[model samples]
Target: MQGFQQSVDIQSLISPLDWVVFAFTIALTAASVLYGNSLKKKTTNEKDNFLDLLLMGRKLTLPLFVSTLVATWYGGIFGVTEIAFNNGIYNFITQGAFWYVAYLIFAFFIIHKIKSYQAVTLPDLIGKMFGPNSAKLSALFNLFNVLPIAYTISLGLFLQTLFGGELLFNMSIGLIFVVLYSMWGGLRSVVFSDIIQFFVMCLGVFLVFSTSISTFGGLDFLKANLPTTHFEPLGGHGLATTLVWGLIALSTLVDPNFYQRCFAAESEKTAKKGIIISTGIWFLFDICTTFGAMYARAVLPEAESSTAYLTYAVQLLPDGLRGLFLAGILATILSTLDSYLFLAGTTITFDLLPIKWREKVSIHHLGVLSTAFISLILAYHFDGNIKLVWKTLGSYSAACLLLPVLFGYLFPGKISDKQFLFSSILGIVFTTYWRNAPLPGFYAQIDELYAGIVATSMGLIICRTLANFRSN
Candidate 1:
């Protein structure tokens, strides 16, 4: 309800020890990138090089798989805290519960199928199933989905909060840091760095929640101080609004990050087990973050929801612990940022480009740099509305890709490639129209995600009927 208000002396909140810890964590992450580069095998074959760079030679161990998957999935940490601060456990239900369901769906139903495909990326898989045109269309949508704009904006906001600089300048610096490390070792670097970040992020949120309980008493304090709406199932939102979040969660079914991890896993069993294990970890982390922010809400009711968790944690944590917490937040953002940047790069080089051009040289590094530059521009353009960036882009991916990708995988030859392409285009058209154009009467209440999905489903059904009629 209140606008973000800054402390007059923001730098004073952080002690010298805290800065040391933050710097050490960042240096350690960069060191992991070098370590990943050391693990790269010397190969002149272009195909092997591509596999090594993007899929880590299809040898992702279970622990590394779990760690990377969990870390990459949770880049929008502040957005989660903001929602939890404002809406209490409802944040867990919408953001956490819905996504957990989606993860299980991927683990149980989709992992085996993905492992069977020889595709290098999600678009490659789409191309194998549908056609080149379909893959290119999906790549365009995948590029939008994996752009890292939201995470860049988050890092910018974090840096601005700490040092008080121009937001765009801070964003550029953060992007440069990620891009530099990411270019050297590719997904291996991203995964190794994620292993460190996964632990840091978990520890950071846990410390905040545990300390809050020690300082402010527990559920009793929250109950007595917070608004009743915070405890409600919908957190005072309409049913449609809550359901729209659930629909967006369906995007996980088609998420490129999930596909990449699954494709990289050494075996189908490892991928399945990794997802199952990561889901448990995610459950614990969500508890820590949601309750931690709820505690912030109770104590700092007027503080900006987006920054309340950080402000309250810094106020409560001791000097050394404060630094670790800050590092954890940065780790959370950077882990996802680098991963998405890599995904965008891979999409461009492997999925979007012609084979001859991509195979002639190592242009993956250039693609990553291009992605970072584009993300910096987009992050600045979006300003700081992380939620809007997520919802808008996420809607397009889910509405257009979910049904087609899932159904295509399940009932392989049933849907034609032309049908897949047409359905996706129809979904895009409806989503764009619903988001930008006013609808007449009751249709106005429908969410853009729903509009896109409905249109896509209709297109699929009509196409299938025509095919069947011709056969008859």
Candidate 2:
């Protein structure tokens, strides 16, 4: 793999037009950061505004919520970085369908539920149902489940390829650029920039696909160049591994972003509409990306898996479009990253941090400090294969949080807080021990979602039983 990566010449990977597009992206991010900083509220007393710390004071609109959802999901897993990691369309395609259905569930079932709570964080929902302690546990669980680890792993792939010999400074500059707007403006900056990024990402993918097909001469070029199972719908992961997708689809129902977007919506009707629309967008995006995997396999057989999308864009697409594609990739990465930073910051500040500290920390300061720390550490995450961490995190998500969330919402007020805590512990223990049974290929073809369902169901039963027994 290293040799294949080493074989590709960096000079061949970049062109002049790509530079202009890249520069423009950097310029735009900077401008947006400056624009967002000006929005900093002037506060007299040094105190955290609970509403601002939690739900952005519920001042969200339709477009902002919609775009943020798009950005939040895109992550480094999409576009070329995905190709770079898995090198096949299987993981990408299968996951897409799983997410599409999940998004619908989020739209109808979860979004309105969270909106009703009017809490800024998912933990807040838990806090409402159980107690502050349950909320704290939920935040800690979610802090690890996000795409940050995956993005961190892929950061190496992008920096080494995108900047090559330039090394640390290259990655640092990119991180700083994202932090500029994201750390300061918090969700406000994250959402506004994300909207633009979604468009930029779309444009980049569109141009790269068009250019690749055109350069290779036509469909015949792609068909001729493709691998044996290149266009296979399931990408070679068998029925169980693939079917497990159905269960896995439910995992996002318990995600922090899902909860956040629900809180961001102006009304139940708006949140409902926003989520339905977002799911539709996800379906289209996922399908197109699967096609992209095939195109890359055809055009750049020698290209590293991660470089598939970037390979076509940098070598095959015109320069200006190449730059746009890179910008889109950055957008995907930063959207997920900044969201985590903000969510995590809020967790430590409002949900998990001691009361005295929470009172002392201003929301703006909290956002800034947390962003800096996450960004700084994530930037240095130059080594290690990031995908495995993400997969593992997802498995953890299904195991630990899934059941508790289900119980929290569906069977609310049925169990004592202590009962819920014990159930969560049991679910996590069970998921940890048995989840690896399903491998990606033929063997343990389980979807992590079902594992989560089982864990949650068992936990719920235990919680209810305990509550019942206690009453008896």
Candidate 3:
């Protein structure tokens, strides 16, 4: 729970060789962006240009799809480490197992239906299913959901740890670097950069885990050194609290990044297979990260939980390998940050903008700039509490959109536009009230997301039943 600005001299722990490796990774990422930018020229048709910018011309192959999807989804790497440091294997269960289940659900039940809509964005699909008003409302929420605040904070923290400067200044520099590369090549650049980052991140965590095993032994070392609760499934948290994480994992069902990648995939089969393959990779990566953080916990029990894994890795690894690990962590965060920034910009340009205005000007760059500014502001406001950012934003998206979007697809035409809109509004109201208002005893124990989802469900049933009664 310690802030990201740790007092430890983290910069001194990093050697020159490590810096060389890190710089090399950044250089490679820049090269990839330049290559991606060179892949296509602007066409006469605005729609085609938009498609190329936003969806990579809907030509994402299986390998690209898997790498991009995996990398983008795991951007909050520091937050994952923080959870594992505090809660042990429960981190995998809450963050990993639940999300894997959600991924399977999306691949099997949702992707094909979404493809049938031929929508450019999640909000576009919402508009198609419900109405423009519904789409606009969903876009408003989606904008908030994809703010990149958490990843921005993670990047800022990483930079601060490396260069020893103001957190805000480091954050700004990192944001600018990503925007410079991402704005030109669009998702194509993001995808290509992600392919390199995907490998680096995997290797980084694997190196940490393997190094820990060699130095400190394995599970026996962890059990002997750490508290008994750390070995427990729930890590001593209450059942309700544990289950809420599972509910939060359901946010994956409504995640814009997943939707965007699926839309970008060359075919429905590619999308489905990509997710399945990515899940297996994610499972293995989770094992490395979760156990790696636990090793940190065991060795550095008194270190800052927010950064114990980083601290341990730098101190433990040899000079050159240490640099590579740091680069991997940076890659993990940058990959997610750029993708969300792009998505937020796309949402503004393609989904939120008035049609006439969009037709009159190519303001996608403006949208990206606007999103970067807003995300920087939010990242500053939240400081370094990545978990809070995730929980708060994930709760709103899951509570408001999950049921409506999923059920709207499953039982199309069964719910009217008015019903969808009202249900979503009800979810927002209930979530807001639950989060902000003082709740009476039993209600206080319930998560705001639970309240929001229940309210939305009730609204849907009431509206549908009333319409059916009137028809009869």
lDDT values for all models: 0.88, 0.64, 0.89
Model 1, CA-based lDDT = 0.88
- Candidate 1 residue-wise lDDT, 57-102, digit = tens: 9989999999999999888888889999999999999889999999
How many clashes (backbone N, Cα, C below 3 Å) per candidate?
Answer: 0, 8, 0
Give RMSD (Å) of candidate 1 vs. truth. 2.2
- Relative to the unseen true structure, what is the C-alpha lDDT of residue 410 in candidate 1, on a scale of 0 to 100? 79
Candidate 2 stretches with Cα past 4 Å from truth are 1-7, 11-13, 36-50, 78-89, 166-173, 217-223, 244-246, 359-383, 435-453, 469-472
Candidate 3 C-alpha lDDT tens digits along 217-296: 98899999888988888989998888888878887887888999999999999999999999999999999999999988
Residue 470, candidate 3: C-alpha displacement in angstroms: 0.9
Across 1-472, the per-residue lDDT of candidate 2 in tens digits comes to 2222324555566678777878788678667656654665666644434454345556667887778888788676533345422434565555676777777877777665666666767777788888876777777787666425455444445666765755455555655555555555566667767777777766766676566556556557655766645556565557765665455556787787777777866788877888888887876676556666666665556665655665555555555766777777777777776776667666666666676766444554564456455645654563444545555666666666776777667766775677667777776776665664535563244555555557667777876777688789
Off by over 4 Å in 1: 1-8
Query: Measured by TM-score, how close is model 1 to the native structure?
Result: 0.97
What are the RMSD figures for all models against the true structure?
2.2, 4.2, 2.6
